[model samples]
Target: MKASLETLEQHFATVIAANELSHAYLFVGATNSGKMTLAQWIAQRLFCTNVKDGQPCGECAECRRIEEGNNPDYLVIQRATRTIGVDEIRGLKQELSKSGLEGRQRVFVIQDADKMTPAAANSLLKFLEEPASQVVIILTTTRLARILPTIQSRLQIVTLQSPTLATREQAIQQLGVDSTFSHVLSTTQFSLEDIQGWLEQVDAVQLQQTFWRWLTQILARKDSAFTLVQTQILSTFKEQKLQQLLPDLLLAALSDLFTVKFALNRPLNWTNQQENLQQFANQFSTQQVTALLEIVLGLRSMQEANVSFQNVLEYTTLRLLVVLA
Candidate 1:
């Protein structure tokens, strides 16, 4: 099941209702952040005939055809390739030259627009300058910084926030993780696909439990925090998974603690330790939390510099202890 984008869904529906929708849009977010889902929802909201309460009647002929990928007016350009080449953009441009088969409105969605080669991007850039009146071009990308400023300036940008903690927990459960496991896995900013990949390679739940214990020990200022790295963390988790997953989890945890310091009503990745985290948050000022975050980020960069994973983790723990002190 997909997590609901209730606010964005409603806003797009209202825009469609008023006929004030823009002809171009750029959806920006990390993977599994509902970029494609929101694009399809907008397509349905525009094409669905039996509208309900500013939402699409998903069962209608128009919506079903769109869902089944049989709609003549709706087009999507996405393929499994390292980079989108110039020829593909030509095909889209050729298609855009024609009138719609079924109606006045036509929707074109380009997934991973950031994958376009320079030539392909230039071709698409020309199209974005002037388009058919009722045609809408939606481009979704995980890397907005890579896109050219010329292309970016042409479209109305829509950003999808990271999924909620409850949404992520549900997704993890659906991956067959035990419901009894602490919801710590939800705190890491990984896509469900990436999470599934790691889960297949290692016992993520067990590693999370170990990490949680180590984390709590660190916050409690216990001496055992230093030894837990060798005894629990390094022993239980595979090196590859540790390199891939641990740093991001650490960053997410540090980010949540930063969020906690301000008493913000935001979701925490470490929901199970909310009480302890808040108590810890109270002890540190905002500058201290920022320092902690920078330390973790520096450790991440050290990994890129080919520092051994054990050294990175050991050093991270030491620096955290020093900073939190």
Candidate 2:
């Protein structure tokens, strides 16, 4: 469990202790926001052999089983493909209908609930109309807008707010990123998983160091980035994977730099390089920054064309020089 979710833990534990648990709950947040962890915590609290004030003894056998993803009464339904169809929901419904004559509690967690097709959502909606008191259904999704309105209204809504800056930085550090680079990486990437995935197959530290160095050089020189581009940007980041990510990185880097001009409330990617960012942003009028950002924003489409990643970077550099001149 994440330290940032301590408040949620306290609130939920009290709810469980009071026996006011809702039969169905919808957890909405970014993928790495700990929704699944919270669901598991609820299960452990209910099934723990030694329960105290809604908190479970993590050492208990049942708690261990759930932690290992093998608890018999706890079933997880995840989308195996792009869409979860009606059959999956139907299967879950059938399982719930079985009479336990002995009556043991059962928990079903559906991951990426927004991936469910209309038919599947409708099937689940019918089940929600009259839920079984002994059964619990938990749905997790990153996109609440994609969830059907009728279904959304039926379940208890749990909105996980964006992680605080301290929380995000701490998580980035735990992922083996350097403390110095954590702030920049966290600002560029929305989630910890995204940061991890974005750095995949690349030397994370090298990418961080080289990228910032290259960006700094370009900012300091207004005439041309040709020397830096050839010596640094082109020398490294040659692989297809790195090329594929260049546009996104450029967009994020520039967007973060833009934050300095407006007293923007969002995080900055290069907080340590505030002077450089301010100087770079200061040279550009509002109209110029807007145009430069627009160009970088369109770099994604440029990547999809026959243009090489190196070509894209060089082209972007040329555009920046043009704007400065």
TM-score for each model: 0.59, 0.67
Top model by TM-score, which number?
2
What clash pairs does model 2 have? none
- Give the root-mean-square deviation of each candidate in angstroms: 6.9, 5.9
Cα error of candidate 1 at position 64, Å: 0.9
- Error at 221, model 2, angstroms: 13
TM-score of 1: 0.59
Off by over 4 Å in 2: 1-7, 10-14, 30-33, 78-103, 115-123, 161-163, 188-200, 209-251, 262-267, 272-283, 291-325
Backbone clash tally (model 2): 0
For candidate 1, the 10 contiguous residues with the lowest summed lDDT are: 180-189
The candidate that achieves the highest lDDT relative to the unseen native structure? 1
lDDT of 2 by residue, 22-107 (tens): 99999887656788888999888888899876689898898999999888688899754657989988998998776433357888
